[model samples]
Target: MIIDYSEQLIVQEVAPRDGLQIEPTWVETADKIALIDQLSHAGFSRIEAGSFVSPKAIPALRDGEQVFAGIRRRTGVIYVALVPNRKGAERALAAKADELNLVMSASQTHNRANMRMSCEASLAAFGDIVALARDVGGVTLNGTVATAFGCPFEGRIEEDRVMRLIDQYLDLGLDGITLADTTGMANPRQVDRMIMRALHRLTPASLTLHFHNTRGLGLANVLAAYEAGARRFDAALGGLGGCPFAPGASGNICTEDLVNLCDEMGIPTGIDLPLLIELSRTLPALLGHDVPGQVMKAGRNCDVHPVPEYVRGL
Candidate 1:
């Protein structure tokens, strides 16, 4: 029987950046490097290896430079880094990141609280970072709209605000733009409507979805976006991430679970589910807490049950 599946989905593994940033205890540079290397070997084409934020702000990823420098650069894999400003962009470039992900929030209040700057200031900084990445870094630039769906302090963000930020990023000549539900308040209807609007103005090639499962609608939201023509997504191993600004924000959608969904639906994500589970199992020792990913603990659907001898006789 021939079964048709959706086109291949590009999964950008974001464990090192979004995953580690919220953790209280810092992961060693060696472990971070090893994790990146392992994910690369596991067939993830793009991996967000680290963020170049201030060590004081996110002590968990203080060794961003060392982590990027130490990773074994495998061919056919793109190493990406999240940069908040020109300084972070410079550091990421020095470490030879293949892609520079510059972030700005949609909500004014949340932007100030998270990045210590207003939305306008962060957007202005994005242009500078984009120029630097092109002129000096020789890297592709990606702009992210953090808290795109809703803000913890400010509540719902208007769709115009999200599109406006994306317009500014597009003006900067960035290769792509990612819309992140930093607080995970996005519903399928909202995602479908927003992404459809984005598609009308921008090519789907230049769009990416960064969803968190904080409100438990992450996978549904992804499906909504996919139906609206979005092919790229950002996920973390063991569903690791949360908002420091949002009181009860949860982890990003789990990579293994997403891959399982893709595999079942005949969508090509190019990620090894078993290897992702193995990678997720190490999180307890690394983060000192239980993660939210179910597939890592329960195993996949293909994990067959053993038949009893009496049943076998029948």
Candidate 2:
């Protein structure tokens, strides 16, 4: 299908939350706050600052409240927090999270494994969370359908199942919806098909695509989503993320790589690529290991390299 891509795309930076949640090394709360502050200046309209789930479940992000309280909140950028249930939603609201991102896997097996509940139970809990958000009265909610493309535990997910989840999200009055490729099992063709179907029912503004680079098709999937008229995407700095619960799930789509791709293609992402690349470069030292982002190693297209003397002579 021919797709006329939008001139502007919304890149929601999820590094602090999804990116840091599974890191083996502990990043200081101060460092995480600092990173969010820096990213806030890089023109991201939405940033997943942290998650409000049980610290026992995700020890890495135990400092979610502190991080939210510490960061210098920008005027236009919305700070989001991932919430698992009503308690999490209440905590996120207390922390002044601009948006709450609630997730449930489309595959029942995966949902049971990840959230320890049946798919119906998870949706019911999400309803309570949405009610809590309404009571709070200032926070927006985003419903994320995890494993929308495919699942490692359950294999391919059905399109009808995904559509039903989206219907639930809309019925719950969620301000946004995200289709997550939780294990990076999505291909470009699959992405296009799913997103096109979603677009038939939702607008570009309310929909977001969360892709992983585990199989090296993250950016390709983004392109496909864009072709299907999706304008919002979720990405992590330096591709620093994986799901400890989901088997074989690896890095998220790199924030720098996605921005660079948009810049090269004349797509307006409203992000500063050089600033993002600089942040990506610091991950190796911060996490005590090199990250998976490519832009930090390859540099931008405009970054010309000097020719070697031998090559110049030739």
lDDT (Cα, tens digit) per residue for candidate 2, span 148-249:
999888899999999988998899889889999998999999888998899987999999999999989999999988977899999999998987656665
> What is every candidate's alpha-carbon RMSD to the true fold?
2.2, 1.4
CA shift of 227, model 1, Å: 1.2
Error of 2 at 144 (Å): 0.4
Per-residue lDDT tens digits for candidate 1, residues 141-196, read: 88888889998888999999888888877888998899999888899999999999
For model 2, how many clashes?
Answer: 0
Off by over 4 Å in 2: 1-6, 245-249
Query: What are the lDDT scores of the predictions, listed in order?
Result: 0.88, 0.91
TM-scores, all candidates, are 0.95, 0.97
Query: What's the CA RMSD of model 1 in angstroms?
Result: 2.2
